[model samples]
Target: MEIIAPGDKFFHDIPEKIINDTRYMSYFKDCIGVIDGTHVDARIPVEEQAAYIGRYHSLTQNVIAACDFNMCFTFVSPGWEGSAHAVRIFKHAVMDPKYNFPAPPPVDAGYPLQRGYLRPYLGTRYHIPDFRRGHINAE
Candidate 1:
């Protein structure tokens, strides 16, 4: 904890910046950042290989990570079994008081329901590339 400074200052500071950014405000208005799980190849004893082999049939270790739009990693949880589900990892991280993961959006908003967590309203323009294209000439 001393190395990471797991406190309000360390956790809330970046969220504030993300909340204020125009490009990220609307779609992920209530979100601090995005969390995702990745897989990295690993080697283990053949007897234990089944536990490490992932859905893709490759030996892997699951790594869950959180990052902001700037691509800065704020949190990382690694070394889970490859078979471990991402949602399970996420739930554990948020529920554990040690991490103090950011609060999720209001439940009524119906987040994480098939929209890749949060989706822009239908017909609404989103994505940084779209923003860049529309504002290419703007100062």
Candidate 2:
């Protein structure tokens, strides 16, 4: 994992894609990567199947992963039961020292906010197409 995994140096600079794209260059200059979770089918013993069953009633494992803007994987944490919430897995990855998750840059580093991730507001129309069509109902 060490060979392919991103080191501290990888998080210090803006991605070339973001720098070149006018739409994201200014907004995402301080962003390092994106993180999310997905469920993958898993085979387990009958006794352990219950823990692995997800909303679809099938055995699966919830895998948390992070990737840079270039879509290259920087970190992956798999084997969590599918029943586990994504936030739970994400919290574990961030708090656990073994994961070696890269720390966010300092607030004084020109970021407007002191946050590691940015999430769109709930129930908001965030797509460019939606804005263009004038469907501006955000509530």
**Clash count of each predicted structure:** 0, 0
Regions of candidate 2 where Cα sits further than 4 Å from its true position: 1-4, 7-10, 107-114, 124-138
Candidate 2 lDDT tens digits, 16-116: 99999999988888888877778899999998899999988999999988888878888888999989998788778777988876656653432123255
* Top TM-score hit: 2
Clashing pairs in 2: none
Q: After superposition, how far is residue 58 of candidate 2 from its true place, in Å?
A: 0.6
Per-model TM against the reference: 0.59, 0.77
For every candidate structure, what is the RMSD over all alpha carbons to the true structure, in angstroms?
Answer: 8.0, 5.1
Task: Tell me how candidate 2 scores on lDDT.
Answer: 0.76
State the C-alpha lDDT per candidate.
Answer: 0.66, 0.76
* Residue-by-residue lDDT tens digits, candidate 1, 1-139: 4222223433334465667888866655555566677889998888988888898899999998877655666678887889998877877876698875555444344334432246346655454446766644432
- Worst ten-residue run, lDDT, model 1? 2-11
User: RMSD to the native, candidate 2?
Assistant: 5.1
